[model samples]
Target: MQKEIKAIIDGWRNYFQGSSSVGLTLAQERAVICSTCEYAKYGKHAAILPDAQIGNIQGYYCGVCKCPLSTAVRSSGYECPKNKW
Candidate 1:
């Protein structure tokens, strides 16, 4: 739980500090992987990952971690629950 908060902090800090929230490369890479992931659920799961955007896709929540990918991908604190990233 605490780790999630730290990841959010790091992600936002990276965003405000630069043009990209997930940094330049790694974050984008993570997003790319997540874009095709079946676990990146949305629609009815909107509340958990609201206002989300990843690469070209809309919003989504990681079915494994159950967190917003937009924010989670940006952070170094949060790792892919499935270790894909």
Candidate 2:
């Protein structure tokens, strides 16, 4: 019985993963970085990622903006970063 239930759960998880939207656009990704930028606390709203320069954002920033960023991503038709499993 436990194995059967686990199989059903695994199937649903896989289905959702395949059907979900992911990733980000250049502009939106920048906005994401800005909102969480470390400099944001000191009044900076610009995204200055030196590595990728201009692409999908994936790095450290203010934890304060995590919730809002997650919401924005969801509203923009993408899955939350924490839900990518």
Candidate 3:
């Protein structure tokens, strides 16, 4: 819960600073970790939207934290609920 708050704050800060994306390398590394995690879930329902997409893959969200990886990875203040990040 606390981590989510920090990420939200940091996201807004970055948005206003004209920096919406993180370093590509870091993002890729995080994505790779998420991709192979057991908690990674493909979002197929309207209520559960994907947080990121790779190629034609729809996207995935963390089953534990219920966060969209696409958005969470981009936040500098984000910490994985499972401490994977």
TM-scores, all models, native as reference: 0.68, 0.22, 0.65
Q: lDDT (CA) for every model shown?
A: 0.68, 0.35, 0.63
Clashes of each: 0, 0, 0
> What's the C-alpha lDDT at position 78 in model 3?
82
Candidate number of the best TM-score: 1
lDDT of 1 at 28: 76
Please tell me which model should have the higher TM-score, number 2 or number 3: 3
For residues 1-85, could you state the per-residue lDDT of candidate 1 as single tens digits? 8977888788666644554544667777888898889888864434443433344334676888676677677788888888888
Model 2 RMSD vs true structure: 11.5
Q: For candidate 3, list the clashing residue pairs, or say none.
A: none
What TM-score quantifies how close candidate 2 is to the native fold?
A: 0.22
Please give the distance, in angstroms, between residue 35's alpha carbon in candidate 3 and its true position after superposition: 0.4
Worst 10 residues of 2 by lDDT: 42-51
**Winner by lDDT:** 1
Residues 1-85 of candidate 2 have per-residue lDDT tens digits of 6654443344334323432123334335544655455533322212332223222232333344332232233232323344422
Q: Where is model 1 poorest over a 10-residue stretch in terms of lDDT?
A: 49-58
Candidate with more favorable, higher TM-score: 1 or 3: 1
